[model samples]
Target: MMLYLAQTTGEPTGGLAGWAIDVIDALGGLGIALLTVLDSVLFGALPIDVLLPLIGYTASQGAINIGVAIVCAAAGVVVGSLVQYTLGARLGRDRARALLVKLPGIKPESVDRAEAWFARHSTKAVLFGRMLPVVRPLISIPAGVERMALPKFVVLTAIGSLIWNGMLLGSGYLLGENWHQVVDIMGYVPYALLGALAVGVPLFLRRRNRRRKNAATAIVETNTSG
Candidate 1:
């Protein structure tokens, strides 16, 4: 789940992928989680999309427990996502979008689109965006801007991230050494993931709309009681 952008940084550990592997090998589950945290927070990209399969391959060699690795990764993503969401909430949409534009590797169009999408879909964006790349992080921003209920935001992020992370980890576990190093995690997703999304999106939207209504009812009740 953890990876420094090997493509750019030339391995944070040392001279070769060998050293990189050594670091990952030595750290195991904790390493995976930590790496994922950074990646989810925009620190790196190699972790989930590229290194996950490697982690699985190593696990197949009995280097780490696949189950533990998966859990750690999923948890890491959730933690990191919450951080991003909190940041967005604190910054507000305009400030956040402005900051994002100044940051490297983030597209302005992506930010604009995500904010617009959130305006329409609100929580549904949070629920499903975790599985998306640019939208995944930026949607959290708008959710923060709109002041989404924290518990609901985290829960939805966890669910979406779990599905996304689980697929990547499982694919890595299955593909092992044969897995390709995907430079773009969102753009280069596995076919299995695409298939899952095709089926899951509609169902997610349906459930999300229902949840939205229920949440409205809860808010009214809370206000009435107070």
Candidate 2:
């Protein structure tokens, strides 16, 4: 609701979320699809929860067809997930786990749980993981490491991604201007990610630079002691 209102009415665009909404509106289905593909890859992309609904909300405005949005969004996720899956298969368990678990924003516990879940329900893991937050990406890697059949991975990913995309998109389509509330209610991972960026980024840089300052202090202390 706030999405299009900000566009036509005189309301302020609500920061990054606002920007993404506007981009989706401007770019249409293809643009939204590209964004999803980028989001799926290991590279930093906006977020599925945020992007899908925003696009869906815009669809409610009749800017992009909901069907088109779903198709493109799901397609992008499948491609991106396949990339990670391939990498995971190549890296194998030990190396893949070592590198993937350490990535920024990846919780080691979530990765562990995803691995365990994959162990028990390989197909379900890929399907359900498509709908989760951090686990979404993590699950793909483990499936790859486990060398789950590619056909099954593709099928599960497509179905799951489509459903996931539909829910968010439908919320926006149905909720109209109140679509933002859907994101607020269901977008914990997205919010957490935003918080991490807004707060975590600066903190990390400070910690990194703090090492240099401490080393300088240590040099001064050593000279004085000598």
Worst 10 contiguous positions by lDDT, candidate 1 = 1-10
Q: Check candidate 1 and list the clashing pairs.
A: none
Question: What's the TM-score of every candidate structure?
Answer: 0.71, 0.72
Summarize candidate 2's per-residue lDDT along 1-226 as a digit string, tens digits: 4365556634346765566666666777766776677777763346557566666667777777889988988998888888888888999988987886678766778778778868966787788667667567677888889889999999999998888788888887888767767767666644554455568658877998999999999999999999
Query: How does model 2 fare in lDDT?
Result: 0.75
Q: Provide the lDDT at 221 for model 2.
A: 100
**Tens-digit lDDT track of model 1 for 43-107:** 23434565666666556657678788888887887788777788888998778988988878787
